[model samples]
Target: MSVEEEDCPPLLETCAGERGNEDDDSDGWDEMEVSGEQTTCLFCPLQFHTIAVALDHCRSDHNFDLLSLKAKYDMDCYSYIKMINYIRLQKPHPKILTESSVALWEDDVYLKPGDMETWLMYDFDDLGSAPSTPHYAIDGKAPISNLSFSDLQRQIQELTIQLKHKDMLLENCHKDMEHMRKVTKTIVDSGDSLNKKIPNNVISSGCDSSDYFNSYSHFGIHHDMLNDAVRTEGYRDAIYKNIKMFAGKIVLDVGCGTGILSMFSARAGAEKVIGVDQSEVLYKAMDIIRENNLQDKIHLIKGQLERVNLPEDKVDIIISEWMGYFLLFEGMLDSVIHARDTFLKPDGLILPNRCNISIVGVDDIDRYNKVVNFWDDVYGFSMKCMKSEVLREAFVEIVPPEKVITNSVILTEIDIRTCDVNACIFSSTFTLSAHKDGMLTAIAGYFDTFFDLETEVRFSTGPHATRTHWQQTLFYLPDTIVVKKGDRLEGTVSCTRLTKNVRGLSVTITIGKNKYHYSLD
Candidate 1:
């Protein structure tokens, strides 16, 4: 054993007196001397018979300062030479030093159980005495000592797990946003396509005024039936001609208003003719079928095309006069598509295969004066209370010629026979440019349809077209602005179809040399 190891008490020797004297006879020490050592340690003190026994006791119990002991002994006294050197530099004895010296030598001290226990009870006052030192700073700069490499590895693993979870959450959020965007786009497009400005008074089966059509003949006959004498002769002649050509073929009559078209098909020698309509209009059609005594040849069913119960690929011909005020007013063409898909064979024919909208400009001087006077009253006051109400009323009255722009300029004509309603996305945009400058008056718009075999319905710039309960819709410019003949009126009208029945349409107009614009919802 080295001189240093011999001088410092071994850990086992310090606690030996606490145990009963099992080696009392082996050691030469008397009972009084052992008791004195026990009093110093406040426990049992160790006994030694030889140098080897003392060295073994120090190694086993004290974790002795081996490098210091080795310097006094031979260099080869400790088998682990590097371990001894490491302990000499890193582990320092706190008992031999003052409190101030111990604090200054903190970096050289090893963490011991006694030191840890003392730290648990250490007060803030003791910590403040060691200024310029971090309270939690551990002794030594070695990673193994300061950070505990195993604990650090476990923390890294936990962070990786948390990161993976966050990435999955982010991916899910992205998918949800994409789905919401698609749904919103669908709704907006549908709103655009089915919007129309048909007059509230026009009696149509699907419109709000459908109930009025029942008693409408008291005021005026249905527009399609107005030319009854001509329609009857034409129907009879067409039926005779078609029946001879298509003997034993099945036929369908869409919007079979009074079943007149179905009757014509039955008379045309069709093997089967089915008439479908949503309104009690089918009842009227039944009456016509009975009056013509063709009930056995025709079958009448009541349902909308969207939910119509019909067998697929069964009919050879589809016939109907489903046109509304401006070609799409009541969204009747949708029903026609449904009928075509459900009943018609691949080679089936559609009556009135193509319909084109024709528009013309007409002068309405009275409407201009009304709109100007109304705006004047509004501007004269500061309230601005009735702007929306005024705008609504103004759009309904006074069909001015300037509002009429030809489809040739703005729209592509619809071919009902070849058009696939499912695959199609419809958009209608209008750019209104001023043709001539005058006191801005009312704007008017109208339409005409061209059917097969030179048959036509001309809703013209005449008294009857304008006088009917379903008059052309109109919009009056806000206030009269003095405009030059060449001044441009720039605006756009846009429409997107959501479904067969629902559509969205908006018109934006700019009038003036400098182009003042306004939008109507």
Candidate 2:
């Protein structure tokens, strides 16, 4: 910034330091009574040659964006008032003018609109000064000591460089924040896209409908099944006697309705127990844990074993009461086998290690005549058409020991640890001899379960033993077969899961060139 010596104010000296021959002039400068206005900044000690140059210096170096200044520096209205007073160096205004006018700047009283960008937001105090008499530098300039003004140029240069450096850092910080926001938005969008990409069939498979879930989710139907002493006591005794297998071990209970088996595991000193079921009955099972105060030891999950994630990666024991009508009617064994393959440890044991499906020849003449013959006539009228439909289905009812005409034969044996779902679809050949000849009405079937305990605990639901919920499944022959004493009756019984109803069974009987097909719904 250069100043011509001719235009310099008489009260302030023009720099002539290097002009060796120039007169060292201080004629009318030192003793001048300065007005403390122009020729020097009222806020700082920096001097300028003219009022216009001083105003330009104020705008270029000291003026700030009002909104950005307050936000970035955490300033309030009072700080802005101090700043405005420091810029203008007039008496602090204590009152405000609400109205705007074109003459406000032109008049000698009011502040000019040229500085309104920074001053508008701050409350301007009047301090009883009249608007017709505004303050401005007339002939006198604001006074400054020569010692403070010596290094003014160097101070302004250093401050300008610092401001530029701060601007660069602030810009970089904003760029980083914007980049993080975009990355977060992209991750959220990807998760929603993955959910939309899933197939409808897979989504529907998780819910229960009439096909497989409704019948099993109804816990009321299985209340009696769980209470059956013949079925439940066998499991309770087997678990209680073998504490070594369960003590300090991790156990997984598949299809754990009411969580009875899981309670047994907890009582047997298991380190951890996980009981899982996909049925709505699982809510009631949670109550059982609370009732027995076994919540700490046993954890129940309301989900299918095939899909539900277990707490442990591997288990030491897998216990479940998965037997259905006729042993494999509901195909619950499939779920147990799945848990075995997926979660069982290398040396883990499966409860009810083996199961035997027993078949016997029954001379249930009374039961046969009641079901098959009743449909043959309706109120003494010919209704033989219904008899064909009745014969196509099997009967699930209790049969007395006297009704069994032949000794029980093991149709098939299953090792629970190694069996799969396909093990239910089987063909078994049977041979039975009649000690006394009468009429062979139906082929009766039942099953016996065994755990590999020391004493070989056994439980059966056959006609020759105490009855269970699964009374006995009877496959009635269409035509009654006559047999003499000591005569042998031989046939192959093919039991399969029906395609239409997954929880139902279908039986095909082949005996003496006669083939009979019956479905149990």
**Residue 253 Cα positional deviation in candidate 2, in Å, after optimal superposition:** 0.9
Q: Write the per-residue lDDT of candidate 2 for residues 439-498, one digit (tens) a residue.
A: 999988899999987756789999988878888988888898887788898877776555
Q: What local lDDT does model 1 show for residue 149?
A: 39
lDDT by residue for model 1 over 131-159, one digit each (tens)? 42322223311222322335345444655
Quote each prediction's TM-score: 0.46, 0.60
Residue 327 of model 1, lDDT score:
46
**Candidate 2, which segments miss by more than 4 Å at Cα?**
1-206, 209-211
- True lDDT of residue 297, candidate 1: 73
User: 93, model 1: CA deviation in Å?
Assistant: 85
In candidate 2, the residue pairs with backbone N, CA or C atoms under 3 Å apart (3 or more residues apart, or in different chains) clash, namely 36-142, 37-141, 37-142, 93-125, 93-126, 94-125, 94-126, 95-125, 95-126
